[model samples]
Target: MSDITVTTEDGKTSVCSPYDTTFVSKAKTIGGRWNGPAKAWQFDARDENRVRDLLREVYGTDGSPTDDSDLVTVRVRLADHEVSYRDGADAKFAGRRIATRPGRDSDVRLAANVVLIAGKLPSTGGSMRYPQINAGDDVIVEVRDIPRATLSLEREGSYEIVGETRGEVDVDALLTEREQLLARLAEIDALLPEPEGTETTTQEAAKALGVSVRTVQRWAATGKVEARKNDQGRWIITITI
Candidate 1:
């Protein structure tokens, strides 16, 4: 909900958000510094990749978007201790479910359908106080306590009954299940504009998205890609494929 803007001057870049404590803190990690006059955080444009990731992590937007459909939001129960969302600097700072037997849930996901914890209080009664989750690949969801609900996926993936009063949930199972839950996040285009003619510092947007650079640029231009840029100049854009 912030009017955070990322702009470039010469080869350096700066991020200006709506005086947010969380944003300013995250921005500082990527070498963002306070600019009294500009009233923004300044850093090198070459570090755009890191900046973009931080924005996505904290606000779900990398100061760019392909389009509206690319952004999504969903809801889920915090069901257990094994699950964690990436809405914070680390798992320790993530938001969490207050209950497990009949846990709380949020629909926070990246375009790739990766599950993420919302940066702020995503629901009523939900608190920002997160009990740290040990980071690992082990994803175990207590399906037995879950209510019956159908989950959707990104890229027209499929529907699955992620919640149920059934049996054991393993890491491998939750890995796939994570997609269903995260796929429901409140997706949307970035409110900020991309700097004109500046080349993107990373190909992650295209590569992780499994799209060509041209396609990525087109998505960026039309707001279809998770992040995109205009091609009004000779500069070429790339993402890590």
Candidate 2:
């Protein structure tokens, strides 16, 4: 867990960091774009030095040393969604272009021959979601080495990698994790007995608070707000508003 990670792959360098407006502005100035699929800002390989300098200026250091030992390079052919790369007389390309009204059927396919020859195809044992692509923008793909546990922890609002819990670590990541833990703990701590607002069911409380019924249920379970289950198996929430 580091404030910033610099990864170089496929002739491109990707820099991942926690969200910061200042860092984002500087990253854009150096030809960096948010690669949604990779969850990182990407730059051309030639800008590696500039990227490092930018990281230093913004974060006081290049936060994490990237390990490319697990990475495999693969070529990706990119073209504008408006242009056709196939033969000029290919009717399918023309038909697709007409169907999209201006866009092309530019599917990002992995080179199967190269994958088989290199024998570097990643294992499919982990949970991987399909990537989302912008319909009209230029197709850009970046592959990074992120662990499966990292994704799982992210869902529960934790970002630390598995088994790296001790020693000198990124201050920012620690601070962020601490904040999240404190917030959840505060929610749970609210379970203490108090008598103030009128008692209502989860649905009534949700409507009064302008939140969803499920949110009220979660609040009851977490003590985020005050609530308890009555004998009838319904949540009895105490809401002032």
Candidate 3:
């Protein structure tokens, strides 16, 4: 950084600082601007006090002195929020405002738009919840490159979700589906016909008859279910569900 000069000429006060990125940046923090000819950093001439104060801080109290006379206030639109401070009506333009309103604050408004700023949409997907805005907050938005057609917020985008994820599949959902598949397979296996001499177990017969194992065993002992023990040492019975 270097020294800043203050001058008053042609009934206009102008503050100038060396044209450098770093110096121009710090100058702007105190409301200085680069609107003058030759690209010098300049700001409100009436801001002599503030300008001197900033220069003093940068170059110490030995910095150049400035003259004080007719004071002026320069107003620039930095951003907009409340109805009173806002400059123009965005409603006059054709576009859409898609986002949830904050229950507590009006500064931020966010819906189900993919957060592609860092180079991706939403990491996860779900339903659209409440608004995400707060009062006095500035939302940094950039224009998406739509080379051909006009771009409007009303149009669907890769950044926002217009609906829910009812049609999507996740891990837990796959597990549930697998369980259903296994149950269906078991049912189909149970329905297969047996070979000519094959028979069902006492328990299988009970399951077919919708009776208890003890009841099936008692019936088999009373010759109710045709039963035999196979060479494999398993109980067998003649029954059909």
Candidate 4:
């Protein structure tokens, strides 16, 4: 019921309607909903950072940055009228005059191996349809208002967006920690002296124990095994000849 005039920096003035004002105010209460495909699709660094940070914060030490290898391939059924894009080989690759194109081709050629990123909701069309995706199918992401450069994967390759909760952890730190733990475990195993009265040579013990010679060496290196050092500086295992 209140009247307010909104003026833009360009000197443009517009009278706000009661309904419009309410909608605008409500939008502010929420995150400011973006309607339509054009508005909904936005590729921004801040948004990308938000998603990345959300993942990292969730996974902790177990979470690491993954590339194409991390993506899970899936396939979804597409309606005949649905529009899809795919990579084409008909275009020229380099100045050498390639026979196939590199960009997206028509939907017909793209039917197989293309992953369904997003499709028209059945509710939008007045029908109840379930969206299903199968494993090993390729993923296709539509480039709308968002710039393609923001995506981490190759723009032309088939990919799938895996849906799973992941938390943030420093990968380098995690790897280092794992290596340290393994080293410590090796040291501990080495410190465990061979059972008393067991007539087993280092190589024989290693073979009988189903462990590598390097492991036996590690035991020797850490002084786990009681052995006699000959003049050649080689340890003769005292367990067994």
Candidate number of the best lDDT: 2
TM per model? 0.30, 0.28, 0.22, 0.22
* Residue pairs whose backbone atoms clash in candidate 2: none
Q: Which stretches in model 2 have alpha-carbon errors above 4 Å?
A: 65-241
Off by over 4 Å in 4: 1-73, 77-119, 124-171, 183-197, 200-237
> Each candidate: what lDDT?
0.43, 0.49, 0.40, 0.34
Give the least accurate 10-residue stretch of model 4, judged by summed lDDT.
90-99
Candidate with more favorable, higher TM-score: 2 or 4? 2
Candidate 3 regions off by >4 Å?
1-4, 10-12, 19-22, 61-241
lDDT of 3 by residue, 116-143 (tens): 1322222222223432222222333322
Q: lDDT tens digits, residues 1-102, model 1?
A: 124467665767787654435667878777887889987778887676688677655544543312111322333323323234334322111211223211
Off by over 4 Å in 1: 67-241
Q: 89-121, model 2: which lDDT tens digit per residue? A: 111110111111112233323321211121222
Clashes of 3: 13
Winning model by TM-score:
1
